[model samples]
Target: MPRLIAPGSLRRIGTFFSDSGYTREALRDTLELSELPWRKLRNLHFLLHKTQEATALHQLARIFYLGQPADEALLRQCIPGAIFGLMQDAEMLEVKGGVAKPACMVAPLENLVLVSDQITNMEVELLPDLVLLPNPTTLTVSRFMLRKRGANVFDLGTGCGPLALLLAGSAKHVLGTDINPRAIEFARFNAALNGIENVDFEVGDALAPAEGRQFDLIVANPPFFVSAERQFVFCDSPLELDGFSRMLAREAPKYLLEGGFFQMMCEWVEVKGQRWQDRLDEWFTGNGCDVFVIKGFEFGAAKYAHERLFEANPLHPERDIEIFEQRLAYYRERNVTAVHGGLMAMRRKAGSNWVRIEDIPHPPKECFGDDVVARFAGQDLAAWATDEQLLDWKPALTSRVRLRQELTARDGGWQPTMQRIDLVEGLASSLALEPPVASVVCRLDGSRSVREQAAALAAEAGADAGVAQAEVLRLVRRLGSGGFLELPATG
Candidate 1:
């Protein structure tokens, strides 16, 4: 059993972690044992292979992340003696098979180190509803969250409290809710471990615990994985075919203050006839919330199952094939075409809400919360702006926005083959420009209106100004909506 670390001991442990450079930002892709990075250790792969050098970080990682037993002497030497003693007293350090091993796994995300079961490290026993380390979805929602200070925040399905911990820094108060009692314990343990006081954990399911509650921001990484069966509360829910995710999208608006934002990571099943976008668009119907959906990589239903089952069957690879087939059959029986997953951001607007959905295959190298929030603001401006207003507004290209020319080698020399304009360092999106559109962009320097620039391009190319005007309007709308350009004056 994993016992809670005492508040007094948590401060000491936090100080030790800070001094040791034990952080997600510090260990990102740096903690390597054999061939795997630290983040990849989230998967239950056995990390019995240790590097030649035995630094404190390397040894601690072996004990904490890989769930391998460290010699009692070596553990005392690597970890602070007082903290080690505290952990031992709290039963966090267990002697299994005469070897001292950590009772739980610790994963670093931003400023916090989340504690959960080392299920992937298990060699024999298997059970459903096992707690998991931070996966891509956990990182995705936390990374994309808007960091609005002094806001009341809620983290639903807050497994191990990674998202809630991250939000506590900016939110005035943060509450994490989960149906699993163990998850509530883990989340609370992590909060005390990090000495974070603004967050409180509650054992509650979905929005039931949040009825009649209002928050300035509600951030959830709910159990939205599309599966025919519910095996785990973290990824699988009792709700059918993304019902829980749909409920959050549809009902979370009622729990938010006016103009408040609700962001979550979710998955949706694409049916035979209905498009995933259309289904998702319908989710926010009559909710009075403006939505922005950032679609991520999707897979055929079976492939998604195969990948998911791989994580669950880490200790029994031989059984993965069987489990995969079982999961795939369930999806096939339900007629799930493709399971689409992504980030959904919604704002509880008063009336006449809008929906913006688009595909974003690759995420940025790191989270830029302000940049993402600003994209929604920029979208609002571009969405409502008329062609005449756009021209009159004379939107200035952001400092980060730039144009790049792609050149190809010919028989003799390289020649410009394509022109692309995008936020060079902003929101990680782009706008490919044709000759005329490229010409118009070249002159969008806050120096000329769209109409004036279109006329200049028409004169230069001997084309109709009306044709140029219409084409430029289309390109500008795309550029603005996609965050390739922005109107600073409006802001």
Candidate 2:
């Protein structure tokens, strides 16, 4: 007999998740169920959406406190058409029983996974490499490109077409390309399932050009693992070591529009004698674009080799000493003592290109990719002082303004001095004597030149005139670059 749902139990479940940081709104939106069943309230709501099966069999296993029901036969019977109907309605469902299925399935933008969808002649199991589910960082990067640029975006090596579908709403046209035909089919089926128009899926290698087409945004989360051998279908690329990065650097520019951005995650080998930043900077060569590379994570050679090899065959009993030694030697020969992974954002510019390489040594485990977008959108130093436009102009001070200096040690133990021209709040202020070097700043009054101010300050403080002059000029330049100060007009 089918177990009856308990009264008020589901509400309690919802309340529990809400208190635990999950939202009631997310459940309603993903499940497409107006209300959750009271009996299944205690069940993990995320797993229900993650599993993608209508009956929530795994969820029910715990809810009923059943010790692993022999097989899914009973669960299927109870749920009947729930998985299918849910997939039909929700558009993405996680089916638990499939052997090759990802450990967790996801429908981007929507949090639900179809855990149990019935498919004949296929064993249900989890893909070993599919440990972590796709999170908001992956989705946000894709969604931002789609929404911001819209017309013509490419989801290169589209695994499940999460980014491609997200692009459908914003982009005038979208293409989801994958090397695997199965992935292509899945992408197409997903597009159709969602009733999404203008998104086309194609089975093609990213290395190959897509028939004379260009995109405003080209996004890829390529298989960046450095492995001795390719094993997993989804995670391993045909290109080894730095192959994916090389391919992206070489090919992505051809497909991008001027000012278009190519955003991706990559793992690069850090070779000796060559700075990792320099190695990554070379990837932007040939492409007339500005590149921003953020090193998000790092792994030693041993750890990297083990992760890739383990995935290839988890049951490999023989720990071959020779094989392990050779792997370490290979990395050492290339001066690659470690593997560093990070987010790379490239913009195709019109003129003299620039590459900004930064080491984000510490990045949050979740959603570090968003930082790439933020940095790309951050204030441009050049734009701050372009001659075409100028910020607010203040009247030249006629009377000499009293300047006072106060130094304080911050939490980081760096001593920074605050230079204030007046006591007025929000007025121009400067930070001086901060570590790595000494500096000074003040408002430029048209009445007195920067040279005059430096001379006055030096005389007042009984300091070297030359030292004071250099410090004042450095501060003025920095302030001008930051849009806080501008060259005073000559009357």
Candidate 3:
């Protein structure tokens, strides 16, 4: 068991990864494979075709990212001499039979250097059961997570501590908790590897690790896989379908400060007889938190079970399909209809709270956390606004918003058809627009108050000013809530 990860060694290795331009795109080009081929080929594909003329990046990539072995001469050529010595001293290098093997996987994810279990590290006896690695779920939460300066943060079920390390750059303090002790150790080692000091890792159950304490921000990507049995500690949950996600959503509010935020990527069940929105709303019962949920892809029970079962036992040549069948049986017995995946954002309020459930099909080009926070603030402002008060304010279209009207061949001529408006950058929200209403929105250039613009639009449409003012007021609230328009600054 190689345990020690010296800080000096990490810094030198981190520099090498940086100078080598080690990115997903780089690897894709080097491997000469697209997404499908990459999935089919894994790391073994690289070793099976290694050439004598492999570059330094290629050798290092295979050794560090793919858990392959390289000769001492090749490692020395790829890495600086001092850094190579430091790696050997820190137990990252296992020398045997004139070949050096990497003990862990160190790769670049965005700007952070993450350390996790190698994809095919055959020294399974030394590693713990089902240790997690940096996966798409972690990347999803990381991209959407809010960063608050000088605030206390907790990462519930932190696997490799990537979220915590990223937050430590902005947060005053961070605590990462996991039930698996090996995960805690890897997280701690990664913190040192990245030279991040404001974060700490500990072994404890979800939310139990931070009991009797309140934080300004908390983010979690818990073990939400609903399973018939807890075969893997990293992904499986002992609770029923969506039981773990519901438990955290229900309990995390009590551990947050007033006006604080708790964000987590989660999956919930869509029961056969119940609406998914209503079932998810039940999770926030008795809460003082305003909830925003953005739903993503959904899967059926049998398909989900088969996919998970296949992922769990990837190295095994022979698999018992009966295990997947057994998991599907549980779902059938519980009358489960489908499984829905999404990310949820909760802001702790004083008393009154609201919930928004949406499926934004478009992906946001910018970070999502800022857009969520802005919408919540806009919602609060709208909740207290009188119709008269709302009419007095000037509103501008968001820079990220755009209007599109589909073209239809009517009478053998291409003409305008249905009009739609959507956000182009931050958060993906779209709404259909009547041509008349769309015309009115176009006139809103922030040059005048809503009262003035609506009156102008009314005159153009031959409608009464007072009547149109009320209608435009509703649009103002809708656009503001959807992050399509920027609201006026409130006192």
User: Relative to the unseen true structure, what is the C-alpha lDDT of residue 44 in candidate 3, on a scale of 0 to 100?
Assistant: 53
lDDT of 2 by residue, 209-232 (tens): 465877787888777777655655
Enumerate clash totals for all models, in the order shown: 0, 26, 0
Task: Report model 2's TM-score to 2 decimal places.
Answer: 0.61
The 10 consecutive residues of candidate 2 with the worst lDDT sum are 114-123
Writing each residue's lDDT as its tens digit, candidate 1 over 278-357 gives: 88878988989888888887888877887677444546677877888877777777778889888888988886877887
TM values, all candidates: 0.90, 0.61, 0.91
Q: Write the per-residue lDDT of candidate 3 for residues 285-385, one digit (tens) a residue.
A: 67778888888768888777877774445545255476767777888999887888888989888767888777864446346777778777677656667
Local distance difference test, each candidate: 0.76, 0.52, 0.76
Worst ten in a row by lDDT for model 3: 32-41
Per lDDT, what order, best first?
3, 1, 2
Of 2 and 3, the candidate ahead on lDDT is 3
Q: For model 1, what is the alpha-carbon lDDT of residue 34?
A: 28
